[model samples]
Target: MANYFVGDIQGCYDELMQLLSKVDFNPSRDQLWAVGDLVARGPGSLPTLKYFQQLDGAANVSLGNHDLHLMAVHAKVKRANPKDKLEALLDSSEINSLIGWLRHQPLHQELPEHKIIMSHAGVPPQWDLNTLRAESLRVTQALQSADYVENLLTKMYTSGSNQWHLEMGELEKRIYCINALTRMRFLHSDGRLDFECKVSPAECKDPDLTPWFALEGKVNQSHTLVFGHWAAVMGEVSSTRIKALDTGCCWGEYLTLWHLEKDEKITQNKLKKS
Candidate 1:
């Protein structure tokens, strides 16, 4: 059995299917790891969720920002973004079950045998593998708890820097961990998150801001990290340890699938306009 790691599907179900076919994926045998943003911006959120659910034990996903937003919208803690095209999913009869499954999904997944870890936005520069695992579990438990809508999702919607400090409250710390694992891209030299910049490295105008993976002395060569956010980079980063799989599939780009054991990639072109 092989392991295939895919980028942000973003509801591009046709592309996802084509890519899986290219890889000759067998739900009963092959394992599929999605780096998240599974639903949103494209045309098939409900169908995409159904497809993944059918995979059962064969598929694993690291929850992305869009994925969390969908759960928040479903729980009535946040309004749906006008451009995400999530109405069909929200209106589905299985919305409750689908959202419940999504909430229980982990923020980080480690493949110790492969020396790899997967997350939506990439692991924080400050966290070691053990710390990453603990923080991920903490957030997953919070999201799966009875008061998730009020305790976690509601408090996690703030924009700008999410720097953690000892003086901050527990809720603030949780929110910071959530942002670091799911929404992080650029970070200031001082380790504060820079949410304003979404451009590729060459296009970024800010001198103080740096891509999280490029931060000096922050590379963790101990394991290969796979992530899917920062589509603007189109799966490019300075570090050899970090592999970016989001090739902007939702933006009329290709959907990337990584063959983990072989360290090879298979890509499928966008099958429809977003």
Candidate 2:
């Protein structure tokens, strides 16, 4: 059975279906891995959540920033950004169950047979794959806790640098790990996470800013890393072992799907307005 890894879906259900159809996905056999952002910013949040939630074990996801934001919005920890287009999903009766499933989804996933690691955002330049897995497990366990909504979600929405520290508290470390896995894009010259820049590398004027995968002496490189969340990259990375999968489908660009075993990329463009 083939393993297909999809880029940030946001809420583009039709595009997702078209890409899956292109690969002739079979839930009984093939496995689907989502780089995350499974909801928000498109027109099909509810349908998209139902589609994957029902799939259960057939599909796996690494939680993205938007997914975590959806949880916060549901719990009244933060106000929903209307631009995210999440109302339909929030209005559904299954919203609660869907949110539960999403909350429990891990921050990282491994396909050891293929020697690949997947996260919504690239792994931090400071840590190896083992650290990623451990931090991800911490967030996952926190999510499973009874007070996650009020306790953790309320504290994770800040912007700017999420610099790590040895003296950081448990909550601070959790937030750092969450941002590293879900919101990271570039690192400052000092190797600190920079959340401000959203432009592609070529367009970025700051010479000190470097994509996480491009940092010198970063990442363990024991396995290939697959990540999304930064649509501006247009699926380009300086490292051969690290792949960017998001092609900006939610922004009217092509949706990308990676064939893990074949090392192939298949794409489907967004449907134009009729």
Candidate 3:
């Protein structure tokens, strides 16, 4: 009856297995929460996808940036760049079904009892649980629809404010995707989205652009935010209630798992890919 949340897997299937073995994870009784990026830049994307596909009922996964990139490529919304070595999955016969399943996953989830909130990338400082879930539902619904979601991904980057507006177009959607997945690291001095910096120490071109969790007057301080995406930050949430999970397992680092109820952590070292 314990729920464990894992950081970005990033296709490190072997290490994932080892971590699961260490925890003695029981699919029937215990549940697993994955913060997303189940594939990409690692050695075992195919197996990882297959294994998790089978664990459909036992686990909950939020889509990560890399996961969306895989989906975009699958849908022909985008091309596979040389850095993306996802050919195995793209060539698989079950590619459509697999991508469909991944796309259907929610962008955010809330566990009221534990006061736990989960998303691949951290939520904006302005959004509370209800606002986050509603906006996320809009994006998820659009992506799942047969409409040209390629347009959505195209506009998912964030060069302006972090706040969502009803007037935003496809470009904003793409910016939202980027902010939610890849381009998030620091907040601008004026509390806008900064798409450039990745290094920590929290200092940047403008020091006032604190990280999202550090923004002043955030409304959703009531719950604990558990997220991944920022490997450089390791597991820093900046704010007291927020927690990061991505330990950079795909980059020769450790895979991290945190127990929701006990606040215990388990780290598994990984073998680097050649």
Candidate 4:
């Protein structure tokens, strides 16, 4: 059996299908690991969710910011952004099941045997694999709890609160963790999240801001980090330990899939323009 790690699909169902076909993926024999944002911005959000849902045990996902937004919108905690094209997904009769499945997905996934880790955004520089796993579990628990929509998802929308302090409450810490693992892209020199910067490192206006993966001696060097979520970077990072898979499929770019064992990359072009 082979393992394939795919980038943020972002509701590009046709591209996903074509990518699978290109790789000749076998659901029973090959495992699919998706770097989240499985829905949003493209034309087939509902179909994408349904297709992944039906994959059952063969597919594993790390939840992305867009995926969480869909959950919040479904729970009426947030309004659906029209640009996301998520209305069809929210209107689906199986919205509950879809959102439930999404909530159960963790913020990070580790393939110890392959020495690879996956997340929507790169893992925080301060967090090792063990800490990442533990913190991800905490977020998962909050998301899967009975009052998840009102208690956790609703409180997680506000940004610019990325710093973690020892005296913070459980809710505050959880929100911070959520933002760090899902929404983070750049970090200020003080290690605070730089949410305002979305351009490539060289193009960034703030010289003090650095990409999360570029923090010197920060990432766990033993394992390779595979992630999506900063489409503006266009799958470029200076570190050998970092692999960026988000080639912006929903924005009419290529959908990338990395084969773990073989270290091979297969891509499929977008079927429609954004």
Candidate 5:
């Protein structure tokens, strides 16, 4: 069976279907793995969630920052941003099941046989593969727990706490791990995750900031890192080991699909909102 890695769909269900059609994707045979942000900021959030929700064995995804925020909104921890066009999704009868399925998705997906790793954001330079698996699981288990909103997600909203400290309590620790997996973009010279800088490296004037993939002495080098997020990067990075999949479809650009076995990329431009 052929495996395809799609970029952040972000509720662009029409483009997703078109991309799948382009590949002649057979749900019974081929598999689609999304980098996440399966909902939000596009015209088709409800149907997009429903499509994957029912696609079952043919589809899988990692959880993105937006996806987590959706859960937070459902749990009354955060208000939904109207700009994201999630009204239909939030109002839908199936939102509970949809969010439940989304919460269960992992933050990172490992393709050990291919020596590749996929996450909403790339793996941190300081974390080895084993650490990625372990830390991600901790958050995953918390999300799956019944008390997640009250016990875990509510306390995770503190900002600017990117540095991982040995003395950190659960709140700080979970925030750090979540940021590394979801919001990370650049890093300070000291290798701390930088959540504020959203510009591409060329536009970034800060000399102290380095793209995470450009950092030296990173521990997880064995596996190629595939990630979506940091739409500003627009599928460009310093090395072959790093693949930036988000093509800014939500911002009037294109949706990208990475054909895994062939190492080929296919793209479909975002259609105008009806």
Candidate 6:
């Protein structure tokens, strides 16, 4: 029985299937923990959603920004971006159920036994575990509430400083959602998210923003974190504690999966011929 952590499977159903086969994934024995963004961008969004939906009990997903955007489009709260190839998903008969399951997923998943936390993106450098827990609950409540999750998801996009401030308003909530779901890459010296940087360390502006893992001093050393937003972040990898599995699979890059307890990389499947 293995607990496998997969990277952003953004509509790459074929690649995902190949990777799973390479790893010999056993739904009955192995648990699949996804870093989210299961749909969007790639070729097979519908099948990806259906696959995960079928694996309901065997899998756990944290909501990714793309997933939220898909939901928002369905709710009629936001228009679909031209770049998003989600028309198939929107047109599918299972749209309601697929998006519903995606929306109901939590933003943060904590595994006490493994002492690990899983989310689509990384936790901010300024937040400790306690603060993260509280904030996660707050966001979870807002998303789960019957009020206006679509509005919230539609507004989620920005660069928020690492610190959590209760004094923040709607914009901050949006920023928080972005930071939690997507648009997070570099952290400013003061811990603010640098939403503009998407390049490697060589191209990114120095002295202002650094990788999320660089903020380790701010987080508890005891707990492990498994995340998948930064596909470019490959070096400085950790097995027993921290892992970044999103090796840019959606961009014709390798798809990765890591087994947590064994602290070993189970599979590294390259994308199949398009």
> How high is each candidate's TM-score?
0.95, 0.96, 0.89, 0.96, 0.96, 0.89
- lDDT, candidate 3, 184-263, per-residue tens: 66766655666567766454556556777666535456778888888888786656687889889888898999987788
lDDT of each: 0.86, 0.88, 0.76, 0.86, 0.87, 0.74
Native-referenced Cα lDDT, model 2: 0.88
Question: Model 1: per-residue lDDT, tens digit, 159-245?
Answer: 543885657666776778789888889988788987889999899999999888885423266888899988999988777788899
Report the candidate with higher TM-score, 2 versus 3: 2
Off by over 4 Å in 4: 217-219
- Candidate 4 total steric clashes: 0
lDDT of 2 by residue, 193-214 (tens): 8878999988989888988877
| Tens digit of per-residue lDDT, candidate 5, span 177-228 | 8898888889998878887789998999999999887875354467788899
Question: Mind sharing the TM-score for model 4?
Answer: 0.96
- Model 5, stretches more than 4 Å misplaced? 217-220
Model 2 ranges off by over 4 Å: 158-161, 217-220
Candidate 3, residue 77: how far the Cα is off, in Å: 2.5
**Taking the tens digit of each residue's C-alpha lDDT, what string does model 4 give over 1-274?**
9999999999999899999998899999999999889999998999999998999999989999999988888878888889999888888899989988888899988887978888898887877666677778889999889988778988987664688666767787787788887888999888888788887777888888888888853445888899999988888787778889999988878899998878888999988555
- Model 3 gets an lDDT of 0.76
Which residues of candidate 3, in runs, are more than 4 Å off? 148-151, 157-178, 181-183, 202-205, 217-219, 272-274
Name the top lDDT candidate: 2
Please provide, for model 6 over 1-274, each residue's C-alpha lDDT reduced to its tens digit, 9 standing for 90 to 100.
8888888888888888888887789998888999888888787899998998889788988877788778778888779876768888899998988876776778778778978888887777667787677766666676666764544655554344344576877557545755744556787776566667777766675777787766673444767887887777752454446678788767877777887767776555555663
Q: For model 3, state the Cα shift of residue 174 in Å.
A: 7.5
With candidate 5 superimposed using the best TM-score fit, by how many Å does residue 198's alpha carbon deviate from the native?
0.7
